[model samples]
Target: MNIKKKSALVLSAATVMLGLYTGAAAQQIEKPLKKNTATTFAIVVDQETYNKAKQEINAYKSALEKQGLGTYIVSHQWTKPEEIKVVLQKLYSDKNRLEGAVLIGDIPIPMVMDAQRLTSAYKFDQARFGFRAAVPSDRFYDDFNLKLNFIKQDSLKAGNFYYSLAPESAPEIHPDIYTARIKAPAIKGKDKYELIRTYLSKVVAEKEQQNRLNHLMVYSGMGYASESQTAWASEQVALREQLPQLFRAGSSAKFVNSRMQGDLKQRLLTEVQREDLDLAIFHQHGESDVQVISGYPNVSFPQPSIENVRRYLRNKIQAANRKKQDVAETKKRFQATLGVPMAWMDDALTDSVVLADSLFEANGNIMMEDVDKIRSNVRMLILDNCYNGSFHKDDYMSGHYVFGSGKTIVAMANSINVLQDVWTTELIGLLQHGVRAGNWFKEQAYLETHLIGDPTFAFTAEGNTDYNELIVNKDGSDPVWKQLLKTGDADLQALALTKIFYAQGAASSSLLKDVYYSAADASTRMQAWKLLSTLNNADFKAVLKDALTDPYEYLRRRSANMAGDFGTDDLVPALVASGIEDWASKRVAYNSGNSMSFMNADLVIAQLQEYLKKPEFAGNTDIQRLIKRQEGTREKVLKEGKVMEDKKAVAKERAFDVNMLRTYTYHELVPQAIAIAADAAEDHKLRLAAVEALGWFPYSYQKDKIVALCDQLIADKNSTAQLREEAMRTKTYLLHFSAEKYQTVAKK
Candidate 1:
């Protein structure tokens, strides 16, 4: 047999071993596709769902076709993620390239593990928590570059297959096609098929009209970026540069903070109901079922403060009672700890006050039940929070927003907890140029992030560029992008830079560096920094040196993040100076402190000691506090490393502990981990974990040591299979990163 046939047979055997239903129905295209069509769209569904909602599905397909898309309906009784991926791959390779797809009804969900680097801060212990900690991702279908090793199908949940990133997979994500989920909520007393049918009709009706990206409503809730007003303000400044058309005369841009309104929940609902509202951005904490809208209310005077304390006490007492805890003891503890009067504790249990406080907290958030009551007119929503897009659950917050009595067509959110450090609005300007929602979302490159609802939806064009055509037709390697960089349009230039970076890899650093210094718009400069940091070359180091002091708060915050990863001694002086100068920005200050903890403890301490002698910083409490914090982290890491030497302790537990060193990316600990990894007497699991942890230190100054150790382990025939495998993976990652870092300068 040929190589392709042999590979197919092996894959088939693996699918059977995983218990995937191989005899299930295959994809059935609705009509013969035209080879000459410029672009194509797909609506994927299970056979039962397609059969039940055929009329509505056809109407949806017709609406897409009416908009000039070559739409196809692909129906299958899918039992494996590979089934759907195969269809998408075939469509993508067609003459009419598949631009976007929407997975409707019961399609396979891929749960990915061992690929934290592809995600924007989703790192869970797959060894301890198993399947529960795995990220439910659709990158299996969209990103062709990722090679997943199928683990198994979930024992309890059909159609949920678990896979791990193959050791040789790319370190980063760049999706080949954009995709979204349109699954109906599996809730009691509701017909899921009916829900799907009605949603399809809604999408069809909305496509008939043209909606411009003119009005934007931005809400910042509590506990996001520590409620840093500077982070909030800097985001708006970036927004202005990104969506210049929205900030022009006659367009509406309203920023509402949790502290700005007495009833923030009601204010949000009222704003979402506005017919003119095109996009609503919610930067807050969220669960699968609720959008957290408020923190403790800001109050003046002693009376309101007393009320707040009373409210908290009453809630805690009530919770204790429900848990069957000793209520008397709880109240006594609260009084003693808080120094509140016994009478106040007694008053806190007043039936009316307890009930009122409960109501206040509930009313402050937009719950899943609350979504049923609102008729939101916002065409698109970006839930910049955690678990709002958890479509794997029976019910989810983003599902409610899209499927409720609303005009909401799409929502971008995460299926798992997400990080605040991500550039959330990176390619948002593409919306103003009439790019489809999915096409723009594909550029985000986060694993847990997903687009719920219609992926092909777009706003009315506000610019001359047909971004839809450009995104679908133009290859990133095309020389035309280089020419487009000469254009004065900042957003367009940013787009060109992104394309060029993807095409040339680190070889594009010279152009990116030039743009970083020369670009007049903060948006372009910010974009340049974003792409340049990924290269990690000398230019990246130079950019970080300058950006640490750059006036842009967001840029400085990101620079601090990279400083922790790079952790070179040369950056310590500027890193400390900016940490002090940008201390007023809470997120920047937090990130700077984190970077200090990750850097060489001795170097950081020496710098702080010198700073203490300067008149400007002498006796500064903040500097003193930072010095203590860095020392404390170093001491703790040392103590943890000592535990790895304890043969009496559980080796598996020690392995888990060693694995955590990667979380801090403490370069100073790399050599210690290397020692544990190289020790033949160490437990196999512990040594393997140590080798895996070394991969996370690709940016460390001690990376060469890890590379040498990896080579030694790979060459040693006596090494255990697990140790050798992990060593090879670590070596691949370190070498690939090194190559990408310096490839641009090699030719020069």
Candidate 2:
């Protein structure tokens, strides 16, 4: 059930107001329901689910209320998210600022369609099965500003505006929506409410077991990309810095899975069998039932445009076989002649050892059954990869391993958009707060939606952790800091700072400034920026102005995001003068084309566009010159790429550097710039790709072709809303650029 509404079934105030249901079998009493009242958290449940699980919910709400979380239980129609939006708006008015929300029941996440083409379809998680439509993000309600007047549904700006992204295919149903799998007596045969209740009950029990004997842990699986691919491969190295808050990581060597000594399953099972873990986190590739740890070699894989490369290799194997060579001899000849690394053809790449056989294997990695079988108390599990949250429908199958009978409350990305590096930093930061797993996971998702620009990742539990404990205490840290300050030990002090302020807590700005200036270590200094980004909300104007100019380019580049998130028009001069460089090598092709990734630069550009829209900065000569400078630089880069890519006469088994693309692109570019040029002529890649960026340039320079063609795209309702938005936004960008040339602001 995709939860599309067929008819409206409205429940009146009388039905909802009557609460505190007590039954002959039930000793628990439900409290009175609060509506239109201020509360810290909002729990939105569907009517059908509410009626079925009334007793369980009452007990749950009662528990939450006792913990200082005044709960608002609101029943909503499954299809009518607009009504839910109304409820949320009322809940988050000027009088009340909500901290978070828990969406209960099988509520439909209405498909989000961006009016601008700023986003791309994220189908990484479900790519294996060609099932990616479910970008089930709660963004629509979460970011609701509550001003949308939809009497005749109008522009997005008219209401609660949130980011929008769609998948290539529709996403599948979330497990919480329908019970297709799970055999746990606590979950199966019961409605989704009971199953979720069982899962929560398990979390409560697991928390009770955390007596400081259970360890907090991090798990990094096999490399999806090589060392050269710093964006993805740098995950573990980055995570190493955040692991200081956990216990005995230095002493517990066996629990860590840095080396793939055996199969991934056996290694994980061994860790679980040996000791209880309070938190277990993984950074790897995953599907609904499988996790990809260490990599075997996959660079030989060809992009769709270069399928001939596959034929080229297969022909070598066939020729050797025709010569009556043995199978091994033929494979060796093929490997030798084709020049594809023989190491890449290793059969074990998809073998039983490195992958999770949770769904289909005789005996393999932690499947659903293994959740209880781990033989130790496991509280929380986080799988940071694609489609990792999609639970399978069989009890003896994947469900046992996925949503275990509360063995662990999991955190994972529903759609794959490269979450490893981004999330590990955010996760470690949240863990410092020592918030309950559920609250911590909610914060993770909320931050992720902003940082990743995709609001599709999810936390399994909502409205749960209210322990209000801090993972890193000043008491444990004050002595270490005092010792470090007395000894003038920078290295030891850096470690102490990690235990004190890696993330999620606040310290005096004066104290943080002292640490920032005094710390000799760069990493320690960077932590100061991390805390400042969150804790120092005031004077961001002045703070960002100074930080963006820091000599550390990494720190300088990070300031782009910080400034963009909290900056107003006033910060434009500082951002432009900063001229920070970001790693813009995000590539599109492995065998076809490698070009400079325009991701970070585009963020900078977007911030500037916002400035251009302001009355004070709009059409200013200085701003115009800066915009032109960036536009010209991009044009030059594109032209250079065009020349280098044009040189590819034949598809090599390796990459053609659209200027060193072969070296650093690591076939991660998939294709050289020339291939992109070729593909556009064959298809529409180049024209479509440049539509938005080119918008920043003068239209006359492009002979107005972009404006005309893109206008047609905008008018074509048959085309996707995403493409049209891209077309119109680019037009808007160009008009802004054009108006600046004439020293006037464009009305758009």
Among the numbered candidates, top TM-score falls to 1
- 566-640: candidate 1 lDDT, tens digit per residue: 888899988888778787898888888889888878888889888899998889999999999988988987877
Q: Evaluate model 1: give its lDDT.
A: 0.83
TM for every model, in the order presented, reads: 0.93, 0.51
Candidate 1's TM-score: 0.93
lDDT tens readout by residue for model 2, 530-623: 5454343443335556765554433444555444432234554465444322223121111001111222334446655667788867676644
- Shift of residue 45 alpha carbon in model 1, Å: 1.1
**Per-model C-alpha lDDT, please?**
0.83, 0.41
Off by over 4 Å in 2: 1-39, 94-96, 115-134, 145-194, 204-214, 224-255, 272-275, 295-376, 391-402, 427-432, 437-443, 446-689, 693-724, 727-748
Alpha carbon lDDT of residue 201, candidate 1?
92
